[model samples]
Target: MSCQHAPSSDGNPTEADSLVIKVVETSAAGKQLSELTKFTASGADVVEITIKPNETYQTITGFGGSFTEASAYLLNQLSPDNRQRILEAYFGDAGARYSLTRTHINS
Candidate 1:
């Protein structure tokens, strides 16, 4: 995954500020929350976005993952040591850091 935060230019700040955007990308090829350095646009590569931070649209209570029977089975297939390593890699401070979970699995 990749993230790009548009420059903030709020000389005269207000609820209506510049429409900043951050883009993150992830790929099965192994990318995980990787940020993009630049964007090479085509002749007509254009889009529109509106940012309204003050608006009350939806609220995100939390973020988390699900545990299924199949997942449990696969996890049990691994040795205890290997399983611990995988757990840490996904929920440890040095890793992805999820919610109650720490995670960067796709940060």
Candidate 2:
């Protein structure tokens, strides 16, 4: 489902908020719970895995990749249609939904 783009108090369209992604299905276990699955190796090896959700651990900030001037220039040189496609492919709900992008300061 698409999110509505609401105007902020400053009267500017909230583009970021409009990009909210509704998750229909996910691999994550239930809230505050974990899922266990078994694995079998080549022949004689067998293993059981436990994902403990109750355990408090370091929370993940997000996933992302680096951005460079070369990458930016490539994107900028693309046609508008192609540029939009690339943007959606990386940032759209159907895409990777990356939220934390990092870039190097040095060339």
Candidate 3:
């Protein structure tokens, strides 16, 4: 489904959200296995796996690579255990990363 772009209270068009995913599979069997596992796992009430693709261009435009780089830098500054946990939670096997695009006006 496509999200709508609307004006906020400040009379500016809101950000645009979209994603295009291309799953990487080594073989046909692997593809089948991945799809099957994902479908079957969804039967449970809780979430099992969540993957979100990043829009490199849009993201770089919104927040420069330095921002993300700095974030990783800060995370690296944490203790080994804490960094591991934070990295796991943020860029774990099952996490979603979203990209937002919009234009802001300066008053």
By lDDT, the candidates rank as 2, 1, 3
lDDT string for model 1 (1-107, tens) is 23234445753344444343456668898987676554543367656445567778888765557556667678889999999987787677887665553334433
TM-score of every candidate relative to the true structure: 0.50, 0.54, 0.25
Question: Highest TM-score among the candidates is held by which one?
Answer: 2
Give lDDT per model, in order.
0.61, 0.62, 0.43
The alpha-carbon root-mean-square deviation between model 2 and the true structure, to one decimal in Å, is 16.4
41-60, model 2: which lDDT tens digit per residue?
A: 33756333333557878989
Model 1, CA-based lDDT = 0.61
* Predicted candidate 3 versus true structure: per-residue lDDT over 10-68, tens digit per residue: 64343442223233344655444232222222245743223234324343433212235
Score residue 10 of candidate 3 by CA lDDT: 62
For candidate 2, what is the lDDT? 0.62
Cα deviation in Å at residue 80, candidate 1? 2.5
Q: Is candidate 2 or candidate 3 better by lDDT?
A: 2
The residue ranges of model 3 lying beyond 4 angstroms of the native Cα positions read: 1-67, 94-107
- Candidate 3 local distance difference test against the native: 0.43
